[model samples]
Structures are given as structure tokens and as C-alpha cells.
Target: MDRQLKPNPPKRKTSMLSYWTLRYFLILCIGFTLIAAGALYWIRSTSIEKSMKTAELLGLEIAEKVTGPGNRLLIPPDIDMLVDKRIKLFNTDNYFCIMVLDNNHHLMYSRPKMTQDDVRYHLSDDLNAPRNKNYAGVTVNITDSNETLGKVWVMQSKKSLTFSTETFVIVVLLLAALILCGWFTIYWLSRKLSKPIRQVAHAAEQIRIGNYEVNLDIDTKEQEMNELVSSFRDMSIRLKQLEEWRALSLAGVTHELKTPVTSIKGLVMAVRDDIVSPQEGKEFLDIALKESQRMERMVADLLDYNAMSAGSVAVRHERIDLHLLVREIIYQWRITCEDKMPEIELEASTGTQYAIGDALRVQQIIVNLLNNGLQAMSDEQTPAFRIRLQAEGEHLSIDVRDYGTGIAPEDQPKIFERFYRGELKKRRTRGLGLGLTYSRLLAEAQDGELFLASSSPEGSIFTLRLPLWTPPDQHKREQTYRSPVNA
Candidate 1:
């Protein structure tokens, strides 16, 4: 069946700088505008209230002055003479007009006597009359010994009691200036922050497309941004290293598998075709068996490495005596490599050292390291392998030393990389180049580390470190609480 390739959807361009800048500008403008408007309204209301209160106080004083000697409300003809002199002597600029109206809605006395049209326009018989836009009015009653006489009306001009249009315009302009400054600050900050983030995202895209050469040379004053760029650069370098190793592994696998299979095939065909005598045929069969063993070993190494990489191998932790484990593994190796065998030595502390790890896995790691050491020593050299065990406060260190030509300085750094074979010219063995890789992975999975401790023209020392195990009685408590049933 054919598979359909779907095109990726186009990405929409977004400007975080523009988005946050506009939001900040609008919020500041609205907030400040409301505050300014509220302040203006309060000032106007206070001024109007103060003016009305002053008008009332003035009316009371005028009423006392117009009171006659007998405490009577003098009629309009008598009031006319007393009111003009009293108003002139105690007048304020707060109110514009004052008038006295009797209970019958007749205008009895007024400052600057009004025409008929003016009286009709200004007069109101109802107590709850709505105020006009041009004036605010207050009414006070005149009383003589608790008897109603007349009503006094005081009107103040709106022009004096409220703010002008010019004043409001000035306040709005000032608020706009502040809002503009805020917008500019927001725009500057957004640009400064988002530019580096955009560059990081762009570099990530380049990496996703398999371009490992992308450089994130961002110069930011922010510490967090600097750290982010540094981490990305490290990731890019690691990916490049893995890419190179993958290519080398592919080539090595083909070569390792092909050599053994070709030898087995050629020998079998030779024996079947009667190219060799009966005795020679038996010898060829023996060589073929060895070649088959080589092939099996290569396939097994590949399977082990794959299983580790897939995380399918579970580690069962247990207490094992480190020195005895190494000695047992060495004994097995001695028997397997009896032909042109390497002499294995175990130098360990007299005391038994216990470690926490899977015993089988730890044995696997040691066997692989020992095999690599054996392979390093050619038939011409006096083969010697040493396993040294030591305990250093809370941890155990195992050193596997081989008496062979040491690894070159250039190859030491990548010695543990998958399928990496150093000193290829000296390697006359037939096997996949994943021994060190598998050993390193196995060691790490068991909460241990494998590293090259030292190397020289004589030999190289590889060290493995694992946590020292404590007896159950000496172990620390993990929990302090228990269930009721357990208790």
C-alpha cells in the first residue's frame, strides 16, 4: 500500500511586542482617564455645594435684618425699604439673584426689581422645580415667631459653580502625554525581550531540519537567556557527535559480519568440492567452527547493545562480594581462552568488599572489559590482565589493567563510544566494535561509572566505581510511619 504525504500547515506570524504594547497603552490610558474624570467631577460638585451653603447663610442673615421691631414680617411696602439697604451692606458674589415671594405666588420684593417677563420666566410655585442648566437655586423660608411669611429664592450662575471646557481639555492632554510615555516604554521592553526568544525558536527549527551547524550567538544582558542559548549550543554539539558515530557504526557492522561469514562459506565449499583431503577437511571444519563462533559473538554483542539502548533490560539490585565476583569471572575467561591464553591476576584488599548491583550485569561488564583487554594483547606479546579492587569511603573502585600497547592520545577521548575501535591497524580480531559501549552502558545502569584511569605505552587502566553496600542492620531507615495493620 502506498502512503500519502501530507503537507505541513503554514505558520501564522505573531508579534508579541505589538500585542503587549497595545494592551499596556490602552490600560494605562483608560485607568488614568477615569481617575482624572473622577477628580474633575468631585471638584465641580464641591464648588457647587459650597456656593449653595454660602447662599443659605446669606439668606438667614438677611431675614434677621429685615425682621421689624415687633418681630413681624413687614409687608412688601415696608420690606422694600429695609431689604435694599440690608442686601447692599451684606452681599456676596456667590449668588446672582435674590427674590421674596409670598404664599400666593406673588413676588413681594426683589433685588433690582424685575420686569413682568423676567418675573414670569424666573418664578415657580412648586417647591420641587427642576434646576435649569444656567443656574442652581436654593429656597429659604422667612418666619416671624414660627408663623410663615414668605419664601426667599437664591440662584447661582452655573458659570461660577462648575469647571470650564478649557480646564478639562488641559487635564486630558496631560493624561495623554503620560499614556504615550507608558506606551513607548512597553514597546521598548517587549522588543528587547522577544527578539532573543525569536532567535532561539529559529535556531531550534534549523536543528529540527538536521542542520547541526546553526550558531546561537545571542548576546543578551539577561542571565536566563544566556543560559538557554548555552544549553542549546551544548545540545547541538552532542547531536553532531551522535550523527558521526551512527555513520561509523553502520560501516563497522558490515565489515565485522562479512569477514566471518565469507570465511565460513569459502571453507565449507572447499570441503564439499573435495578440494581438501579427509584429514585437511577435518582441519577446515575446525577453522569453520571458530569462524562460526566469531559470527555468533558479533550477533550477540549487537543484540546486547540494542537491548540496553531500548531499555528492555531490567537491573535487579543485590549485594555481591566484589572481589570474589571478579575472581569467578576471571576463572571463566581463563577456561574459554585457553589457546594462547592471557594470564589473569587479581589484586584486591584482604577484606571482602560488598557492592549493590545486579550480579549478572556486573559480571557481564567485567567479562566484556576483560575480553577487550585480552584482544588488545597480540599473540607476540606476553599477555597479562590484572583486576584490582579497592574501597574508598562509601564507594568501591575496580581497576582492569591490560599489559599491551596503550591507546593513542587522539583515540582516548572516544574510547567508550559505540562501535569506536582505536588502533585499528593493530586489531587482527574478528568482532563487532561494541564491547566498550555495552560495558559502559551496563556499568551505568547499575549505578556505577566506567572511565579510563590512565594510559601509557605499556598499558591502560580502566576504572569502574560503584556504591559500597552496607549490611541491613547498618542501613539507614527509609520511612518513619507505618499502617495500623502492619503495626
Candidate 2:
């Protein structure tokens, strides 16, 4: 039994939940990160450009105010008042500086008065710094229609941008929620799918340990899944049945061979020891020889069955007139049976019954059926049966129906099981019950089948179906089917 087992498979101990959820988690996180990075990039670029544009416009406005219609400088007091108010208002939610320089490179006006070094030190190019720290300067030329009067420099920094925007916040929350929901759903589905498979694996383990009584009643809401469970359950049941049959078959084989060996030993020893007179000894020797022959037949049946199982027995396939074959087989069997041969009414078809099969195997199957029917009526004074031959679909069916008390209802289904002898057969016969099982195997080996067609108290019919032969050119070939008796 241990030798029958397949090699143990290598293991990767990972739960399906973790395998799927973690992998998807990584994928979703990567996707979210890329999207967030892209959105932030767009927002930062837009904010930097917007702040620069606003500063450029402010520089133009300041230059326009600092100049008169003829492009001359404004009065210092007027410039002071205008510059102070404008700078204060612009810097309310912003950080910027305003400066006006003359055409001779002299600083004419500076808001909050800073030197060149102070201006340069306060300005920065770091785009991601705080809005007040990341300052840039935009210089707009102060000019009339013909000549440049002065320049106005507007220093401004970018507005702050963060993930705290209301729309972006809402989208992040929604994305997080969707990712969590999707992961949870995937986890749930993985559990549902893996649960049955895990159960089946466990059941297989139980079977490996020779326990076939595990009944899994899982109701997975999938058609193929339910079928898988159902098939496993059925296979376990069949394995258990076959196991039981195997034990019974062993016991039956042992008991049957033991009886003949014991009888032969006793009879032979009695004659050798002169326990009986010459005439009685001769008769005893005859009985011993018959018993030995019976044992040989039993052993032969066992050998033949084993050879067939090992695929060492080859069967020939050829076209033969089944009608003629059956007639000759019955004739040869009747010669052996002599006076006790039962009446067999052969009801054959009028037309030829050509079949593609092994002739020897066919003879064996028909002979086994005849012997089974004959032995079934061991108690009857006049045993009888009928052989009905007919064309059924694409096969020729030979039904060996017996008129004796039919097979016991309980035993009918198992008659073809190896070593399964009925109660009546057990009482009347002294051989291993392999005839029907072997005959069925032979029938199947030749692209044929044997089955009990019907059974009742009054009679039983055993049928053998043989494949009909057709010529290679897709037409029926004719053979004159002659009965051996008529011929």
C-alpha cells in the first residue's frame, strides 16, 4: 500500500489571502503614488508660473505709476504714498518688494529700502521653499514712446501648494476607500475559492492514509466546484467498496482452493496406504484426479486473470460470422456435457451477424455464460435456457437467458464482481468465482461489453454486445451465416 503512493509534492506555504491581497496592495499603492505625484507636479508648475505672471503685471503697474505722461519721475511724496499703500496691500497675503531705478542706474525709489546685497541675499530660486522664501524678481522697463525712462523691479515668491486642497483631499479619501474595499473583496473571494480546494486537499490526505469515510458536505455556490466535491465523495465511496470486495475476494479464493487441496490429499493418501480395496482405491484415485483437475482449472483461471491484468494476454481481432461461431460453440459444449446437457434454444437472426472481434475470446465469453446458466439450475431435473441473437444499434447482442430460478436479487448486481459467488453458487460449486468477471473483461478487451440485461424470479438474461464489422470502403460485406447444425 505504501508503495502504491505517488511522490510527495514540494510545498510553498503561503496563504491565498496574503498572496493576493499583498500583491494587489502593492499594485494599488504604486498606482496611487504615481497619480498623486503627477497631480502635485501639475499644481506646483501652475502655481510657480501664476506667481511669476502676477509679479510681471505688478512691475508694469508700478512703473506706470512712477512715471508721468511724458515719462518723467513722479514727485517723491506722491511716489512715497502710492508705493507704500500698494506694497502693503500686495504683501498682505504675499511677499514682494518694489523698486524704481532711473536711467543713470541710480535707485530712485525702494519700498522698505533695501541695498543691492540685501535684495540679492533675500531672493532665492528654490521652487519648493515657503512662499515668502522662494522670491524671484521681474523687471519691467519704464519707458515712453521713444526712450527708456527707468525700470521697476517687482520681487515676488510663489504661492504655497500642498495636498490640503479640498478637491484633492476628497479624491485621496475616495481612492483610499476604494483601495481598501477592493482589497477586502479580493481577500474574501480568495478565501472562498481556496477554502474548498484546501478541504479537498485535506480529504486527499485522509485518503492517502487509507481512510475513505471522510464525508465533505461543502455547498460551494459554484457548479464546477460542487461537482468536484461530489466526485471526490463518490470516489471515496467507491474506494471503500473496492477495498471491501478485495478482502472478500481473498477469503473466497483461499477457501475454494483449500477445499480441493484437502480432498485431493486425503484421497491420494488413502489409496497409497491401502485403506481401501483395489476397486475402491481405483475409484478413489479417479475422484482424486477429478479434484486435482478442478484445482488446476481454478489455478488456470487465476493465472489467466493475472496475465490479462498484466497486459500479457493478447487477443486477436478479425471478422467472423457470429451466427456460425455460436452454433459450433454450443455443439462442442454439448458434446462435453453429454446426458446432462440442458436444452438451449438458439433463436438466431436469419441474416448474417458479422462482427469484428477475437474469435477465441468470444468463444470464452459464450462458454462462460452457458456454464453459469447451467450451474444455476443444479437442483432442477431438467435445466433449460435460450440464446437470443439480434442486431442492436451498431452491435450484435447475444442474450443467454436462463429459465432456472433467477439470480438472487441481492447477488444480481455483483455477479460480475471478482470472486463474488452467489449464496446458491457457494453451496453448489467448488471453484473460484471468476468466470463472469473474466468473461466481462474478455468482452471489453475486444471492443464488446457484457451485462445482465434483465433478471427476475422466473428467469435472467445475460447479454454480450459485439461491435458490428464494416468494410474499409464504408459498405457492408456479405457472408453467408450457416448454422453448424443445418450445415
Candidate 3:
């Protein structure tokens, strides 16, 4: 069946405005709140300092004007008049009370209608102390030519400071409210902007799980998000196309299977009918067997690649001695290649060389490398292959080297790609081209890595590194063995 090809779709870009709006609005709100708080504090502090200074100046002025021989130790009538004028001024200016006291702690003068006796007593006691201190009352002592006449005390109401503090608190609360409002605004805006993205993510997830019919339901009024949804929808369509293509490829591979089986069946029937010589029939049977093996290997590799791609491959993990594992793999490969007469080499350090890994998978990786090395040198006059193992720190390294015709620079990067055949167009051996890819995948699944060290005229070196393991008991045994015998 003919399949339809889908066109590539453009990617959707996120809106720059959304980010800018949130960032700038939050910054402005914070800036305004901080500036407002700082301004209010400065105003309150300046106003309080000015009020205290004004009260001090007035007290000094009254003290200077009221001091005399009669005023020195006595209450003068002019002093009373001056105190009354100051009291009227203070009251009009929102001050609580004003009082003038003699050196004898006598309230010589006070504000009119001052029924609160506690105010007067507090002032008297505050001024009579040896050291003048301003508390609730900002006291200023009156002295004439170094003679203590009395003290002019300006008592500011606790209400004024209370009012200022309360005002500051209210301003702070307003700032907090503003911050809260900004947070709400940002949250609401982010949610609105993210809604379409969430939908697109859901659709993509559906597609990921093999749902090719998933479609995005998004509002086109939001231009940017609409574009994103459209792009995702297009991606879904392309994935569907690829899935169909894969089905077709599998069908093609299956159809191809029939030709070889038919050829083998025809050859077997011809031999039964005695249409060819026995030797010729034997050759045909050998070819048929080789072709069958090729088909089996191809199908097996395809299944492995599919399993790996689907993330369904299970790796059996356990603590394995690297030295023993490498030795076993080398021995098996040497036996398999006994007729080829390829040279094999091993190098390792003296230690436990233990690693947490899957022994079978490690053996598979070694086998794949050995097979590749052998194939690369099949045409050479004297094919030689070497396998080396070395321990370094917490890692064990395996190097597989071959003295064959090296891979071309252009083919080096794609050598590990599935189904990729290098510069040698006519394959020397029947392979599904998944050896290196499967080996790399198996290495990665074990928390190890595989990479081509170098490819030159001297051939290629593929290195494999797996993490080493050290048990606590082995460490204790080594420590005990190192202890002095005399002790």
C-alpha cells in the first residue's frame, strides 16, 4: 500500500511579553512599597526631632526671660504669664500640656484646665532629678547667670508617638497588601499563560505512549499558545506517518523473507527430483543454510533494537570480578576464532578488580568488539586482534584493538549507528549492523560507557569502562594481613 508523507511543521516560540509583564510589575510594586516605607519613616523621625527642638527652644526662651533675683528661688508673676502663653501655644500645636516648676518641686505655673494631676507630678519629678533626662516630658531647665531658677518642662502626649507608630504600621500593612495583590496578579497571569502549554504537554504525552490520534484543544485567541498547540498537533501527525512507515518496512522485510525460503524449497525439490549433481545439491543446501542463518540474525537484531528502543530490556546486575569476566570472554573468543589464527593479548593489574555489572552483558560487549575486529581484518594478509584490560582508580577499562584497515574519518562518527554500514559497501560478513550500537546500549545500561579511542592507519581501539566495587570485608582482610606479625 502507498503511504502518505507528512510535511514538517515549524516550532512555536514562547511570548516575551508574558515574562516581561510579570518581572516588571513585581519590581515596580516592590520599589514603590520600599520607597513609601522609607519616606514615611523619614517624615515621622524628622517631625519628632523638630517638635523636640522647638519645645527645647521655647523652654530656654521662657527660662531666659523669667530669670531674676525674685525669680531665682521664687515664682514670679511674669513667669506665670510667660508659662501661660507657652501653654496656649503648645495646646494649639497639639501638645498635651506645658508646665513651669520651681527648684523646690513646686508647680508654680501650669496649663489652664489641666485636670490631669499625673502629668504635673511626672514633670516635677522628671525635672528635679540631678541629671536632666527627657522621657515622656522633654524637660529644659531654666537658669539665670548660672543660678537655678526653675525648669520649663514640655510634656509631649504619649498619644503623638502612638499615632506616629500606628500610622507607620498602617503604611506597612498597605505595602503588604500591595505585595499580596501583586502575587495574586502574577499567579493568575501565569496560570492563564500556562494553560495552553499544559494542554500541549498532555497531548504530547499521549503521543509518547503510542496514541497517534491525540489532538490539541487550545484557544487560538492566545496567538503564541495557539502556535505551540498547532506545532504539537503537527508533530503528532508526523509521528503517525513514521509509525505507518515502520509498518511498511516490517511488511517489506516479511515479504523479502518469502524469496529465500522459496529458493531453498525449490533447491530441495530439485535435489529430490535428481535434477542436479550431489555436489551441486550440497553447495545449494550450504548456501540455503547460510541464507537462513542471515535471516535469523537480522530478525534477532531487529528485535533487540526494538526492545532497547522501547526501554523494556532488563539487565541482570551483580558484583562481578572484572579479571575473571574478561578472562572468560577472551578464552571463548579464542576458541571461536581458532581457525582464523588471530593474535589475542591480555593486560591487567593485580587486584580484586570487582565491579557491579551484568556478566552476560559484559561478555556480549566483548564478543561484539571481537567480532568487529575480526571482520575488519578478514581481507588483510596477516589479521591480528588484541584485547587489553587495565584497572584505574574506581574504574576498569577494556581496550579492543585491531591491526586492520582503519575506518575512514567520515564514517567514524556513524560507525555505532544502528543499521549503518561503513565505507566497505559490499559487506564481508552477514551482519544486521547493530553490533556496536547494541554493545554501547548494553554498556550504558550498566552505568558504564563505550567509545572509539582512536581510528588511524593503525586501526581502531574501542574502550569500555565500568565502575569498580570494593566490599568492606575485603578491605578488613587486607588491613589485617598488613598488620605486623610480631604484634
Q: Highest TM-score: which candidate?
A: 2
1 against 3, candidate with superior lDDT: 1
RMSD versus native structure for model 3: 14.4
Estimate TM-scores for all models: 0.75, 0.78, 0.47
Candidate 2 residues lying further than 4 Å off, grouped into runs, are 1-12, 53-70, 73-113, 120-180, 265-285, 471-487
Full ranking by TM-score = 2, 1, 3
What is the C-alpha local distance difference test score of each model? 0.77, 0.79, 0.72
Reference-based TM-score, model 3: 0.47
Q: Write the per-residue lDDT of candidate 1 for residues 1-487, one digit (tens) a residue.
A: 8989899999986688877888888899889889888988897998788778877876776565555556555544555555555546544443467776666556765666775456567754354342465788777888788876667777767676766567778888888888888888889989999998888888889889988787787889999988988988898898887887787778888988888789999999999999999999999999999999889988999998999999998986667778777877787778888886778878997967888777787778877877777777666897798888998888899999998777889999988877778755226676667888898898899888899999887988999888888766646522221211233
Q: Judged by lDDT, which candidate is best?
A: 2
CA shift of 194, model 1, Å: 0.5
lDDT of 1 at 386: 84
Worst window of 10 by summed lDDT in candidate 3: 478-487
Instruction: Kindly list the per-residue Cα lDDT of model 2 for residues 1-487, writing each as its tens digit.
Output: 4668788898877877678879988887788778877877787777667666766777787777777766687734676676657656644343556667677645677776777655435543331122344555577888877679987877654443222356578768877887788778877888898889889889999999998889697998899999999999999999999988888889889999999899989998999999999999999999999999999999999998888878888986777799889888888888888878678889986977788787778888988888877777747547787888898889989999887667988998888888889888888877788888899889999889999998887778999999987765536544444443454
